[model samples]
Target: MQTSTIKLLRALVCMMLMNSLNAVADKVVTDSPVTDLSQFAYPVQDAKEAFKREQYAFVGIQLHDTLETPGVTAREVEVWSTQPVEPLNTRWQSFANIEEDRTALLRLRQYANRYNLMTLKLLKEKRRSDTMRYRY
Candidate 1:
């Protein structure tokens, strides 16, 4: 009789634990919000990494012919956590124009990739002109 009672008590305790675990699993969130995706960002690790990450916002800067790509300049831009920088695949497509070599991404090795001078190519300007013509 004593052994049977102990077994029953153990089973009851396990059942109660399972119920509590199920409740916790149901309440946990699995997705980040649309506008506040920073929740999923990796934490800013070091000062050097932070500075490098911050430079990503200036990836396509130009000054010679007022042709600055103005990255991170125009509003309605997407930005997650600055401190914890992340990767991206940005492009500008229109009815008649589609950017081909466009890249505004933050790489793991920030300095090595930031100044690749990709925007120096004439492809983007050509695409923009076509887009303007289509727009008008």
Candidate 2:
């Protein structure tokens, strides 16, 4: 009887140890490394290098003396280029010229004051009804 009791106690202890081991195994946890933008196939750092450069071609015109007549002395004229050169192209090339060979003229027939200007005229190279001329 003593030997049987010892065997039974040993068996119970073994069973308890196995159940505790199973519980611990079921509760086990694991973790992976933290993910960042630099680890992907297309990393976020590559966008900083991709950029573009734009060039604007402009022209200005000033009258010899408009203050005495219409109070407006000079005016600036701007025209967009057909083909704008990019930064990757030749750096020493000249800017594109005006397509239409005409002069923009501003007429000062009347003057309100020595500083105020009036009566502006814009002449087109070709006669066109769409052309507009105004003053501020």
Could you tell me which 10 consecutive residues in candidate 2 have the lowest summed lDDT? 106-115
Give me the runs in candidate 2 sitting further than 4 Å from their true place. 30-136
Minimal lDDT window, size 10, model 1:
93-102
Write candidate 2's Cα lDDT for 60-122 as tens digits.
222222112223332421122333211111112313211111211211111112112111122
Report how far off residue 47 is in candidate 2 (Å): 26
Residue 38, candidate 1: how far off, in angstroms? Answer: 18
* Cα misplacement distance, residue 86 of candidate 2 (Å): 37
- Each model's lDDT: 0.34, 0.27
Cα lDDT tens digits, model 1, 96-135, are: 1112212211221242233222222222454577689977
| Clash counts for the predictions, in order | 0, 0
Clashing pairs for predicted structure model 1, backbone only: none
* TM-scores of all predicted structures: 0.25, 0.22
